[model samples]
Structures are given as structure tokens and as C-alpha cells.
Target: MPKQVVPEGARRRRRPTRQGTVLSEELIVRTALRLLREHGGAGLTARRLGLALGADASTLYRYFTGMDDLTRAIGDELMGRALDGWTATGEWRADLRALGLAVHSSYLAHPQAAVLTASRVTGRPREIAVDETILGILRGTGLPDGTAVLIYHAFIDQSLAFAALDAGALALTDEARTGDEGVWATTYARLPAASHPHIAATARLLTDRMPHSAYPAVLEMLLEHTAAQVAGLNRSQH
Candidate 1:
């Protein structure tokens, strides 16, 4: 089939069929996301996507070159959602914290999709904007150019790494998720105090807290260390 060339940033034109269902790029991407959520990562094939969208599997290629292209679009959409409605305050540390939390929360919102796309570098609009925003924030810290770049690399990579890892845990099958959650309460809590004194001493707290994702705490630690480094730089420059 010939490629259907669509203009950049143009709303996907929906083609109405005798079946009465309209198909567009946005519709395809949204359907793919839904399939991923409902059926897990293996659920997002072209056949399943077509079945969900009420179109032929071949119809997807008109919008995306193939499944890989489609996945990248999905990744970009996640990035778009992460930065949506986000405005940076002039305070660099506060702004970075808000941005980090926004990214983490957005990924957790669609854990299955996040597992698939969180590590991808989609050079699309929203992804590009996010990269630029991170660099801009780091530069605003008054660090030397080399230091700002290094911190930018660490900050962005650390956020994405944690987001992907946490989302992966969340994207597990229901049975797997239940089993994993139970490990802290069922297994660890049952350990003998004589054999594991430290664990037994704090078993209750561990069981309560271990079920929660550690992304927020980890992100705060990263920001705090970065802030300390920035402070050191300021002191050295004076």
C-alpha cells in the first residue's frame, strides 16, 4: 500500500466507513493504549488494535509506518501527558521536584504503557520539550556549564530509570502483583525474631511501607543531593 503522508501537528483525519466507525491516528494510538492496559504489554498487536478500533489491521500502517513507529508515538504521548499543565517556578530546586513528581505520576497512571515506552527516546514534540525543560532548569541553577550538563544527564536518566522500574512492577499481571505484594507481609513478617532480629523488630513498619512504590522517596534523595552539590558550587565560587 502507498504511504499516507500526513502533515505535522495536523489532527488526524478520520475516515468514515460503512461500518460507521471512524478511524484516525489518534484513535489508533488511544486504542493501543487501552489494549495495553486491559491485556498487558502482549495485548497491543495490530490485529488486536484493529479489532478494538473496528478497522482492518492493515489500516494502521496508513497512520504509522509500522508497529515500531506506533510504539514511539505512544511513548511521545506519555511524555506529553507528563508535562501537560506543568509550569516552572523560578526556584530551581522546587521546580525540579515538581517536574520529577509529574513525570513519575504520569508514568504510574499508565503502568503498562510506561513499561513499554519509558526508556525510549522519542524525538517527538513533547519528548523534545521535556529534554529542553530539564536542561533549562539545570542551567538556571547557576552551576558551571560542565556541571549543569552533567547534572542534567544524571537528573533525567535517574528520573526515567526509576519511573520505568516502578512502572514495570505495577504492570505485572494481577496474580504476580498480588504475589509480590504479599511477599513483604506474608514472608518477611513471618521471619523469626531469633533468626532475623532487625527485620523482626521492624516487620510491621516494613510490611506497611514496602507495598508502596519508592520512586517519590528516591527522587527526593536525588534532588537533595543535587541541591547540596549546587550549594557547594555556590560556596566555592564566592
Candidate 2:
């Protein structure tokens, strides 16, 4: 499908916030984000981003101090877009499941932007809020604070790790075409049954699995394990 046109506001020029001139983090991030999506990870350098925004590379320096900062901003912005309209109903498991799936879906949606954002936590507002929510859910389970923090960290990391890896492979990596198939055929299916019985048993299931179901299916198993951990903790505390 043809990508959408950049709104006039999304472009940047070296100028202060003046009566007629509009300079914003959103504008800069969005333009760079568009470029990142279209050109893959290597294309999001400060020079190319500037050119895409109709300005010199130096103009971007005014908005973002450096490429790393700019990349983080772009990652945070993409996270925000992925999180729009998400509300919780106080069902902790469902809320967390929803949150994880939301983030995964969002990151996967813009696999380009996600390739950069998923690995690093910029401590951006949306990310902080997401963290707070996850920890809050764990705490609500009545576990001690330390335990809650550890579990929450593990859960968040795992979800993002899987999400980011798949996104990177699908959108950012060069072997997008056959890397997935190679893993299924040459790696998992080839393992001897005596050495990897479970994997070998599930080889056909793994082989028949479609690309789209990969993230969500793995996410379900993660949630199940996490939920059991929470349950175990609850029992121990009682």
C-alpha cells in the first residue's frame, strides 16, 4: 500500500518557536519515523532525516542533540502511537495480557521503528506508564515489592525481546525472505529426536505455523508461565 503523505507540520527547519514558525519534537520525530519505516534502520541517520525534512543535518541538532537521542525520541513516539486508546479494566491478568499484546502489536506494526525502540528503555512517559502498570499489576497480586519488580522486569523484557526480534527480522533485517523458513526447516526440524525430543515432537507444528501467529502464540505461553509464578507467589505469601 502507498504510504501516507507527511503533514506540513511534520517537517523541520532551523527556527525558534515563533509566531509563524512551528518547531516541535513531534514534527521531527514523525518525519524521521517515516524515513525509518521506509528505508530501514540504516536510513535513519541524522543527515538523511534532515534531508527528508527539507533541512540541513545541522537543523536536526537543534531538535535532537545527537543521533542516539533522536532515535530514542523516534522510538518513544512510535510507542505512543502503538499505545493509543488502550484502557485497563482492573483485571490484572487480562490487563497485562492486553498491554503486552498491545505493545507487541504496535511494535510489530512499525517493525522499522520497533527494531530500534524495543531494545532500549528511554524512560519516556509512555514507557514509564507502561512500566508502572505492569508493576502495579504484580503488586496488586499482593507479592512483596522486590518480588514484584523482578517478575515485572522479566515479563516486560521477555515480551519486548520477542516482539523486537521478530520486528527486526521482518522489517529491518536483510534476510526477511527466508530467515524464518531456514530456522524452521534447518534448525528446529533437523534436531535429532533423541537430543531434542520436545522440539522434534513439535517440529511439524512449528513447521506448519504461519508467520502472523508467532508473536501472539509465544506471548500466550509467556503469560501462562508468568501468571503461574504470580499464583505461586501468592500461595507462598499466604
Candidate 3:
């Protein structure tokens, strides 16, 4: 990537607000994250961000090239937070499971931001660190390098894909979320048994369970299959 142009001379100096809070790229990205959380996706505009930071909208351009650059920075921050306290155990399967859950939970915590950033490959420092850490974990499992790379691709993609999809649901407006949450209970549960035997038969279970995201269960399945594959590869090598 080409070097992002920083504003010249005077603009490079810290700009203090009337309240004495200094503005910098870090502060801007942090404020943007808050704006995204309090307001939804549409709330993350230059005007709103400026208001939130107590700086002029034009000041933002001095820091970020545009909204896209700021967003990628925010995404990199999210990746950093996911692995904040994570240290890998020598046990590969357990370590991967922990990392996967950490990533999922971090995105869920910032659903609005995740909606914008989860599918993106930011290539920023923290994002690159996450990619490296995951690949290392998979390779340590003793899978062949080729197999490790393939599984690493699948694991990371699946985790982020589901995170984005689930976060999209969570990011809905209150009314929409409520209506969606009630679908299994209100719609599926009410279908006549004569017309929808299978759905009707399991409607009670579905109503009780369907409102929850299934990412955790799905992650476990992926990890278990990968473990099985690794074990089989080890046996064959011996």
C-alpha cells in the first residue's frame, strides 16, 4: 500500500479543543468506534465524528485519508482487542478454540463496527498479527504445510463469515431485532401440524433455541473435524 499522506507542518501538531482534549489519529479512531456503537452504521459520518471529537470535520482528513482508512484502522483495533490477553497453549486444538471464541465475542461486542470490518482484509499491524498467530497454531498441529494453510484459510474465513452474519442480525434496529427474535416462537410454533409436520413436531425446541446464535456450536464442529484430520495424519506418518 502507498504511504498515506499526512497533513503538512502545522497540521501535524496536536490540535487541542476548547476543553483541552488533544486530537490525534488514535483519539479519532477511538471516538469513531464509540460513535459507531452509540449510533448504527449510518451514524459514522464525518459530521458526526467531528461533533463527537469536538473538532472540525476537515480536521479528520488530516488524520485519515477518508472514511475507508478510518474504518480499516477501527477494524485493526477490533482484531487487537480480540487477541488482547490471548496466549497460545502448546495444545493446538484448545488454543484454536479459545482464539475462535475470543474473536467471535469481540465482534459481537461491537456489532456495528464488525458489520463494516469483519469481511475486510485490513493488512494493518494487528490484523496481520492475528493472521500470523492463527497460522502458527494450525501449523503447530503437525499437519503438512499445505494442509495447514488450507485449514487455516477455512478456519479464519468461517469464523469471520459467521461473525459478520451474526453481527448483522444483532446490529438491526430494536423493532427489527424483536420481530426477528420472535420468528421461531411466533411463526414456526404456530404452524399447523397437519400442514407442516416436521417443523411443527420440533417447533417447541426450535422456539426455545433458535433465537441464540449458533456460531459457537459451529466453531466446535470445525475444530473437532480439524483435530480428527490431524490425528489421522499423525497415524499415517507413523
lDDT per residue for candidate 2 within 100-131, as digits (tens), equals 78877778878888887888878788777777
What's the best-to-worst order under TM-score? 3, 1, 2
lDDT tens digits, residues 1-238, model 1? 5466455455343566446766677777788889989998888898988777777788787678788788999988877887995787888888888888888888788899989988888888888998889888888887778988888787778777888888888888779988998999989999999999999999999999987877778778878888998999889988
Ranking by lDDT: 3, 1, 2
- Specify the highest-lDDT model's number: 3
What local lDDT does model 3 show for residue 104?
A: 85
Compute the lDDT for candidate 1: 0.83
**Model 3: which residue pairs collide?**
none
Task: Provide the TM-score for each candidate, comma-separated.
Answer: 0.87, 0.77, 0.92
- Superposition TM-score, candidate 1 onto the true structure: 0.87
- Model 1 stretches astray by more than 4 angstroms: 1-14, 18-22
The worst-scoring run of ten residues by lDDT in candidate 3 lies at: 2-11
Question: What would the C-alpha RMSD of candidate 1 be, to one decimal place?
Answer: 2.8
